[model samples]
Target: MPEKTTAENIFGSIVETLAESGSKQKSVSFFGEEKSNPVASQFNRLFGRQKPVYNLLGGGKSADVLLWRNKKVSASFLTGATAIWVLFEWLEYHCLTLVFFALVLGMLAQFIWSNASGLFSSGRSQTKVPRLVLPEEIFVNIAITISAEVNRALSFLQDVASGGNIKQLLVVLASLWAAAVLGSWFSFLTVLYVGIVAAHTLPVFYERYEDQVDSFVYKVLQQIQDNYRKLDDGVLSKIPKGKLKGKKFE
Candidate 1:
């Protein structure tokens, strides 16, 4: 036989795997019932018969809207839209330049203060002026950080896929797409700075107003869960299972 190319071999293997799985399903049906998945069963017990994600994605919106009806999706859509509008309408070229210039002035002021107060001269025979961070080092560090983040994301997706929950996968995919759409409207540095600032400030604010914030968040989540429970009982419980197309539903 002529040797198969890499693509041909991969295609052949996929076809073979499908054939084997179909045969196994048939055999199980003829001989005995296939074993049930305990984990899937547990998942069903927790969120089955109900919309896997009922409250948040659903309310006052048609289910036909697909992923757009989600709370986070709406939040992100509005945030992105507002950001773009501000960038195009209110913000000017000089505004952006001045923003960067302000940072430069702040650093210059800090340098002057430190030198005047003998901070840079404390131990050295002569005061040494600090140089700007090298562009190459900055780019290399960013590349390394991005690579690590991508690997971590891939590993997380692999673990979730292994769980075999279609609903979970859909949620993850929807969230990622929404985040990417939002990210497209803003620079990575802007997002990073906002995230960093939020990380620094939000904790202190929460700590200061712990009880009130906790109570409010608890009430909102409680309301959402209650709505989910109601919707599940009203509609989702009545839907019957059907065989999935293109494969034997196992």
Candidate 2:
């Protein structure tokens, strides 16, 4: 019971961490406020609200090198394994048509959700739902769903990590689902694999860029401070100390 509780806590922490990471990504748009630097402003204008994860892929062959270095091979191997598992299980289910139909339905649902969420517009809209509510509510719901799934995935990983009664069969089943729904080839699985691999690799790239941003902002602040200091010492020093026409000097 104690072990189980400990495991649950760890799992919860992982979920919270993933959610926080995702939320941080979501906040890139907010960082583009009027007072923010020009680069951030430009970035916000260019990407609008949704910032792509690959934006972290700093640049060039180095990024590619990092991806391959981190998780490309493992993700590919898992994908291939998942594909085989999916094929074997698909023979049992024989529900390709139903799956495709469901996929279309899901796509339609997503389209509706996206539209209703006002992700397509600014805060104001003449729709049934409140304009202010749309983006925040939808994003909140999405975040909850994502956090739940991530929690489940993290639990699975934790079990494997701790050498607990790891369910190979369940893993195989999940792999099959991944391959079937997401696809084994250039599909969801491929994209997911790329994303995970990129996530592991691209932070280094992003950190460097982040450091540059920090330095730039520091320089800007430093210049502003110097200007303020100069103005205080020179111009402000020359101001008359006596009472003015309409007001007494404090």
Candidate 3:
């Protein structure tokens, strides 16, 4: 047999190891829904959907601009939306009294502001700010990915390695371990690992969302996971059966 150099042998081993280990994580689901254009979905998901009410983008009636121009009327809509989301969260946390208080106070503020500032406005030709256009689906997907990784790490450490810690201790330590492991994994892989796999099966998850919009991140993740599961199963089975060899370095 031809003598293989140390560098070649090491690179070959690394490639083989990666190819083998890759399959185990191939099937894991990251996020809840599928996305077509993640950045747009993220924007809509975060800032709430843009309405035809005000032309925030040029050639439009600037609701926020109008609010700035005539603080009273604009404040009502702005405050109302803010309060609604805030109140929703408060209610979710079971803070009924606080929600009631917020409602009462929010109503009073809107009432006072509406009377004080007359609702009159015009569109301004101000330049728009440049921003990273990550979609809601992508944002959600990333969050889900991070959460799943952390959860997996903790579960692996706690359940698989029983007697490692008490319940309270497990809760504390698991959170910490999960964060560290997740951070490390993200730092190492970036999106290339998942992105590559997602490319193969795009059509499988290409369902439309509300309206005519499609989600990108969700679909990508779905495909990636689909491919990953297949990869993981294939690699895992071949692990022990595969042959290994050594070479000396000069």
Candidate 4:
């Protein structure tokens, strides 16, 4: 090989220095190894990071574009949904199936309209293809999270094998089984939506007519208490009580 010249020596030294610096630098990742205590840092110590709520993406291409329309749309959707739910409940109607059917019918109608006219205001809907919403990394991350959940579930089974509370374990298993069976048919989402509706309306209604609601509740409670007292005297009184004189953990 030919002798290394002065310029070649300088270039080689610069490359070596860059490689050393790059190796020592911390990697920039979506998630870091550092455990963030969100409850303590962000929430408990509000303004700890001193971040501005507005203009977070200040230096981006979409800088100064607040997208207030998105926020307004969300607020409108929530308000409209709540009003509809209240009206439907008052009318004694189940709207879950209706909502699902309406969505399907609406999409089909739009597709037919697009095919016939091909003049959608947003774009030519008939010509446009459905785009992927998430990045490839997002799908990989979701799969990893699901695998972690499955691992934890399997770990619970391992604990059950290692002489865990059989009664408690069995009860939990039974509850999960029943939930899965019901969820398969009626759907957990439908249950959650109904629960939300009940929460929004029932408490307000009860508080508005507190006296009447409480009187009805009290009568039902009185009947329950009488039955409970009878059962306690007949059955529970005959059951042997556990000793509480131990100093050690159960």
Candidate 5:
């Protein structure tokens, strides 16, 4: 009986040890998922992106359109853009010619409808045709918005030019160089259409695969930073910088 009781006690202790180890593993995995990598946290803070991509993009109807929250509206916009691009690029249609043709068609339709109604309504009152007058407020609002954006862009450029941020200056220079290269490759209209297409497509794709993109971007940024550091160490640090004496105020 003593031997049997000792064996039972040993088995119970072994089971308890296994249960404790299993619980520890479960706790460790739960906490591991909850905790973010310290390096990733540092990089995220450095990148100054605390909000989600959608929220950073104004988080309204514009965000919804870009992210394709409403498929019908998004598809309609893409279709309209594609049609315009096809007309201008493929059909080689001039803006003024298209405008005049549209006006002529409208006038013809109105003339036929007005005269045909009179001919068919010999014993009845003729139905009134509605006039197609565009609202002045739409044009005014569009002009105002464009002006504001232009002013803001001018202000931002001025700040970047006057500011002492070498990284930002380099980024602006690189972007301008890229734009120049792209301009050499494609016409302005083609570039604009491409930009519109990219704006419609890239945002939705990025939103769908945000985590993978973020991970890839983080890796790329790290590599770029390391290369920049090496360049600075090898060349930039060796460059002679003149020391300026502060003016004395008596």
Candidate 6:
């Protein structure tokens, strides 16, 4: 009886040990998934962005168009822009000439329609053709929007020029320099079209590969910060500034 009890005790101990180890393994796996990538977590915290990319882009019609949610509308807009670019750039068509030709064709069609309708009618009365007149509100709204955007841009430039933040000043200067370099390389219209194409494509691709992009961007930012720190420690720290002193009165 004593030997049998000893064997039962050993079996029970083995079962408890195995159960504990299994639970520990499960817990370790759960926690591992929860803390998979510390860098991604740090990136999210640094940016303070808890929303998804779609919401970051305002999550409306504009975002939908950019992300290609409505494929028909998005494709139509892209095709129209491509057509216009091709017409002007490849075909060498002048904007004013195109507008003149379009207007002449529209006027001729309307005139023919009006005259034919009167000729077909039994009565000898002339039919009045409807004129195409744009609304005053459309022009007024466009002007107001343009003025507001211009004022906003001017305010931003003034603020940047006021020189409170050295970092901001450097960034603005770098951006302007980059823009100048790009202007030297390509015409304004080409640059604008490229920007439009980027806007149409980049957002969707970023959304699709968000995790990889975030990881890459985090590494890039970390490397930039390290380089800046090295620059500051090596060069900036060595620079000496002259002390300003008040003149003594006689």
Q: Tell me which of candidates 1 and 6 scores higher on lDDT.
A: 6
TM-score of each: 0.38, 0.19, 0.19, 0.29, 0.73, 0.71
Q: How accurate locally, in lDDT, is each candidate? A: 0.58, 0.56, 0.48, 0.54, 0.76, 0.76
Model 4 per-residue lDDT tens digits across residues 68-168: 22455534554766676655655555678778888899788767765756655456445553443667998999999999999998887778767678896
Model 1 vs. true fold: TM: 0.38
lDDT of 1 by residue, 1-250 (tens): 2223433554565566556655655554456566434454443332123433324335354331223446565456546755754664557335577689889997988778657757556775655556656679889999999999999989999988898999999999898897898799976656664664454345445434333344334444555565556555655665687977796788
What lDDT, from 0 to 1, does candidate 3 have? 0.48
Native-to-model Cα distance after best TM-score fit, residue 208 in candidate 6, in Å = 2.2
Per-residue lDDT of model 6, residues 199-220, tens digit only: 8999898776455446545555
lDDT of 2 by residue, 219-250 (tens): 44555565556556655666679875876789
30-146: candidate 5 lDDT, tens digit per residue:
454333355764455425767776887798988888788888988899899889989999999999999999999999999999889988998687769889889999999999999
- Candidate 1, which segments miss by more than 4 Å at Cα? 1-146, 165-167, 184-193, 239-250
Of candidates 5 and 2, the better by lDDT: 5
Q: What lDDT score goes with residue 20 in model 1?
A: 60
Question: What alpha-carbon RMSD in Å does predicted model 1 have with respect to the real structure?
Answer: 21.7
Better of 1 and 3 by lDDT: 1
Instruction: List residue ranges in candidate 2 displaced over 4 A.
Output: 33-177, 180-250
The alpha-carbon lDDT assigned to residue 232 of candidate 5 equals: 64
Query: How would you order the candidates by lDDT, starting with the best?
Result: 6, 5, 1, 2, 4, 3
* TM value for model 3: 0.19
- Candidate 6 has an lDDT of 0.76
Off by over 4 Å in 5: 1-46, 228-250
